[model samples]
Target: MTTLLIRDGVIDDADQIAGVHVRSWQAAYRGLIDQEVLDGLSIPDRAEGWRRNLSDPLPTIIGILVAERDGEIVGWTSFGSGREEEGAGDGEVYGIYADPAEWSTGVGRALLDAAEQRILDAGHTRAYLWVLDGNERADAFYARQGWVADGASKVEERPGMSLREHRRVKHLAGS
Candidate 1:
C-alpha cells in the first residue's frame, strides 16, 4: 500500500469525491437500502452538489477532507457542527465514504482519524455520526475506533422505503 495522504478537500475534487460517494453507497448499502434508490444515483448530479458545497459551504460545515493514495482519491469525509436540536455532541461527522475497491485498506480509518482530530482542534470534546441501522461493517469499524451506539435511532424516508439509522458517539477529550 502506498502512502495515504489526507488533505483538505477542494472544489476540484468534486468529481472524484462524487464517484467515490456513489460507488461506496452502491456497494455498502446494497441490501440495506432500496435497490432503486442506489441504482438511480447519478455521479454527475452528486458532483455538482459537491462542487457547490466545497466552493461555498454553509457556516455549519467545518470541513471536507479527502484520502488519496498513489494520486487517486480513495475516500473522503465531511464534518461540521451538530445539526440536530438535541445532538449528543457539539461536532458531528456528516458523512464518510471510501471507494468500494478500497475498503479495509485503512482509507476510512485515516479519514476518520483526521476528522476526529479536526473536531478536537475545533474545541469539541465529543462527536457523533449516524450509521445505517444494519450496517454491521460500519458498526464494527466504529467500535474498533472506540465509538459506541447511543441508542438513538430514526427512520429516513426514501423513494420506495424507509431506512433506519442509529447514532454512534465518541468522546474526543484527551484523545
Candidate 2:
C-alpha cells in the first residue's frame, strides 16, 4: 500500500509543482485541448506563474498540496480564493494534477478532500472549479464527488488557442 500525505507547498516547490502541472495537463487535456495550445506549454513558464501566485499577499491564498508516495511527490492540488465577483464565498480549485502512475490511487480524491476542508475551515460556503467542456473523465469524477454544473460556460485560453470551460460547484456544510 502507498502512504500519501498532503502538505502546504513552500516557495521551493515551484519547479516540482510546475513540472507536475505541465505533465498532467498534457495527459489529461490531450484529446480535449487544442494541440496547438498544448504544444506551447513549458515548465519554466508554469514555474514563473506559480511563483507569482505564491507571492500574492491577500485574496489569493494559493496553496499547493502534494501527494507523496514513499517520500516522492507524485501529485498536487492548488486552491485559492475564487476569482469571480459573487462567488467569493467559496474557494476555488484552480489546478489539480497527478502522476499517471498514481492515477486512481486516491491521490486526487484525498487532495480534494483536504483542499475542501481547508476552504470550509477558512469560512468558505462552498467550492467550485472550471473544467474544460470535453473532459468527460474529469466531469464524471467531480460528479461522483457531488459537484454540479451551474450551466455557465466561459472561454479560456491556454497559450495558442481558446477553449470553453464549464463551471462546477460543490456546496459545503452550512453553505
Candidate 3:
C-alpha cells in the first residue's frame, strides 16, 4: 500500500477533484437515487461547479485535502463551517469522496482527521454532516468515527430532485 498524504488542494486539482466527485457519486449513489438523476450526472458540470465553489466566498469556509499516492492525486475531502441555518456551533463536512481503489486504506480517515483538526483550530468543538438515508457504508464509517445520528432528517437537493438524508454529528473535546 502506498502512503497517502493529505494536503490543501491547489487550483491544478480542479479536474482531479471533479473526477473523484463524479466517480464516487456514481458508485455510491447508484440504485439509491433516481435513475434520471444518475443519468444526468455530468463531469464537466461538476468540474465547473467545483471550480466556482473554490473560487467563490460564502458563509462556510471551504478547504480541500488531496490524498496523493506515487505523486498522483487519488482522492480528496472538502469541508467547512456549517451553514448559518444549521444552528450548529461546529464545522461541517460537505463533500468526501475517495477513489474506490483506496477504500479502507485510511485515506478517508486521514482526510476526516485533517478536517476535524481544521474545525478545532477554528475554535469549534463539534462537527456535523449529512449522509444519505440509504448510504449504509458512509453512515457506518461515520459511526465508527464516533459520530451519532441526531434524529434529524431533511431533503437534500440533487439533480432535478431531492433525496432524504440524516444529520450526523461528532463532539470534540479540547486538544
Candidate 4:
C-alpha cells in the first residue's frame, strides 16, 4: 500500500529484477505451466540475461521499466517497437513480471499503465502483447484494462514442450 515507484531500468538493477522475474514465474505459473519447467528456471541465468538486456539494450527495445516498493525492485515490464509477428501496431509490451508477494498489490497494474504511456510517448499509436493462452488472471487483468484478444496465437517450445500464447491489442486515443 505504500507508494510504488516505476522507473527506467538500469544495469545495476539486473540482479533484483532477475530475482523478481524468476520467482514471479514460479508463483504465477505454478499451476498454469509445467511444474518441472517452472522449477528449472534459474535466477542466475535470468539475471545474466537481464544484465545483457539492460547493459546492452537492443535498438528496437525502447524501454525496460522496474517497479520498486520501499527501494526494492519487485516488478518490471519491457516495451518497444512491435514485433513483426503481430497485428499492425508500432509497440509491444514484451512482458511484465512481479514478485509473488507483490501480486494483487497494484504494482503490476501500475507498471502496465506506465508501459502503455511509454509506448504512446514513443509515437506508437497502438500496442500489443502476447500472453500465455491459459493464464486466466492475466487474461482477466488485461481485459479489465481494455485489451482484447485478437484471435492470434502461437505455439512456443519451452523445456521440451510446446506452449500456446495468444495476442492482445489496444488502440491509443491519439491513434
Pick out the ten consecutive residues of candidate 3 with the lowest summed lDDT: 53-62
Q: Native-vs-model 2 lDDT?
A: 0.81
lDDT of 1: 0.92
lDDT of 1 by residue, 62-139 (tens): 899999988888999999888887873589999999998999989999999999999988888899999998899999
Query: What are the C-alpha RMSDs, in order, of all predicted structures?
Result: 1.2, 2.0, 1.7, 1.5
Residue 61 in model 4: lDDT: 91
Better of 1 and 2 by lDDT: 1
Model 3: CA > 4 A from native: 84-86
Residue 76 displacement in candidate 1 (angstroms): 0.2
- For model 3, residues 2-120, the per-residue Cα lDDT tens digits are 67778888766777888788778888898888767877788788788778776773557757788888877778887888873764677888878888777888888888888888887
TM-score, each model?
Answer: 0.96, 0.89, 0.92, 0.94
lDDT of every model, 2 decimals: 0.92, 0.81, 0.81, 0.88
Which has the higher TM-score value, candidate number 1 or candidate number 3? 1
Cα deviation at 143, candidate 4, in Å, is 0.5
Native-to-model Cα distance after best TM-score fit, residue 170 in candidate 2, in Å: 0.9
Best by TM-score: 1
Candidate 1 pairs with clashing backbones:
none
TM-score of 3: 0.92
Report the error of model 4 at residue 114, Å: 0.7
Deviation from native of the Cα of residue 145 in model 3, angstroms: 0.7
